[model samples]
Target: MKSTLLSLLRTGEGEFVSGEKISDQLGCSRTAVWKHIDALRKEGYTVEAAPKKGYRLAGEPDTLSVHQLKSRLPEPSFVKDILHYPSIHSTQETAHLLASEQAEEGTIVLADEQTKGKGRLGRQWHSPPETGIWMSLILRPDIEVRSAPQLTLLTAVAVVRGIKESLGLDPEIKWPNDILFNGRKAAGILTEMQAEPDRVHAIIVGLGLNVNQDYFPDELADIATSLRLEKGEKVSRTDVLEAILKEWDWLYRMFLKEGFSSVKPLWEAHALTMGKEITARTPRETLKGVAVGIDDAGVLLLRTKDGKLHHIYSADIEV
Candidate 1:
């Protein structure tokens, strides 16, 4: 009922929607309409009501519904389209389909709740309702297929920078792309690419950020932490999302102008894995070494105890 009422209110686009019309459209009594309106106000919605003018949606709170998001971000930085869902199987799955259908570059898919959220290594990312930012971006950069991995690193730098500036809290990046605070996971990025031989097609970048969760499930309670838990107060998902998108637009423009070298140092500055001794587990074998740095190709440089430097393309790092 709130969804339907919200839709009707948005149809007005700041104009007043009469109580009689809303009741007729929703097939509810005038009193029921008033109750729903009051409920929305209690949830921090700004609704203006008058004797004869009926109700006007002044503004929405920090919810991530498409209407609120579109209204809050009146001018998009670089995003082409924003497709929002109340609940989805996976933003990445829907983005893959959209990209295949030639959706414009910078199309974003966002969900309030993901029933089957995905993580690295085929793990499930727990995304509770109204607690996090779950979104996927479709990017069609004109670069070689080998260079797509750098986009992940670039995104990492943007997330850490956005969080620091917006929330005034310190956060670090765990390569290839994980946002960490106080040695616990706060956010993760998954980058998937579709390419043709010797050319590139589209890259789908998925970001899951735990913002205001009060508690996690038993299994994730120890391994996962939300921005609220880390900061000891509630955090706004909309604010964080807006900051990240803006920073991403700026960094992405830099990458397109100067290439990955421009983003390389920025990523290194936020990386928590740099100059640390860790064990890296790849598909082939496991190696223990001190993390030196990343190459221009975005591969990890690990110096083993034998003074040998090896490029690690993919691995699970245990620090």
Candidate 2:
């Protein structure tokens, strides 16, 4: 009901809509309409209510909610179901629970802040309130467990494409999952999966994108940056999210039809690690080498100075 009222006011686009008209359209009393408008204001919507003019939506807040995001999405199929939280331990953990309960594909678990947010190799992701995009997408892909890692690369490609399209910035992909802007980290992708040996269950792709932060903490000051910091102005998080979903939907369908072979070239085009001297630190050991490229299974292929080729299944790369 609140969403409906808000939508009506938004459709008015700063013009006043009478309380009587709102009550007639929503089949509610003027008092109820006034209550809903009050609620909208409380949720950071600047709704103006005059004596006779009724109400007008003056401004929107920079917050992520089901109402705001759904209103911005181009199609319902992009996000069939969305779970929004003001603050949470982790969107990835909640997404896993929802997927286990048979949540539909394209369902999203989003939060303004994540208390226990994580990145690859179990590192903590910095997700401050209302300044970054902390969301997990639940995907049930019909592929083998060995092929599941390819989705991470595909997601990186989609994110780069989305950022380019929305912000007009060409961010570079740092091998496995980091998105960099001017050599500083802008986003990270963590892809986890549940599967049998031969078949797959669900893949949860978690994305943490710094959007509107003015500055990072001392620990992250050297490496982390936000869209606003890069662009020198605030960019719409809704627009970035929508672009990502559209790119994800498009690339996912392409991957399904043509496999990772078709998607690998696109990922390579925006890659920052390729053809660069780097060090890859895995669980067992670290190796310094020139990053040749990715192999057929999307593993990083590193050519060491000793001229031996190494396949990296999972590693942290430093360029």
lDDT of 2 by residue, 246-297 (tens): 8888889889888999899999999999999999999999999999999877
Clashing pairs counted in every model: 0, 0
Look at candidate 2 and tell me the lDDT of residue 198: 80
Tens-digit lDDT string for candidate 1 (1-319): 9989999999989999999999999999999999999999999889999888789998876578565555655364568789999899999999999999998899999998999999989999998887899999999999998889899999988888889878988898888878988778999999998889787789999999999898999998887888899889877787888788888998998999999989999999988999999899999999999999998888999999999999999898888
Model 1 residue 234 distance off true place after TM-score fit, in angstroms: 1.4
> Which parts of model 1 are misplaced by more than 4 Å?
1-38, 41-62, 65-76
RMSD of 2: 4.6
TM-score of 2: 0.82
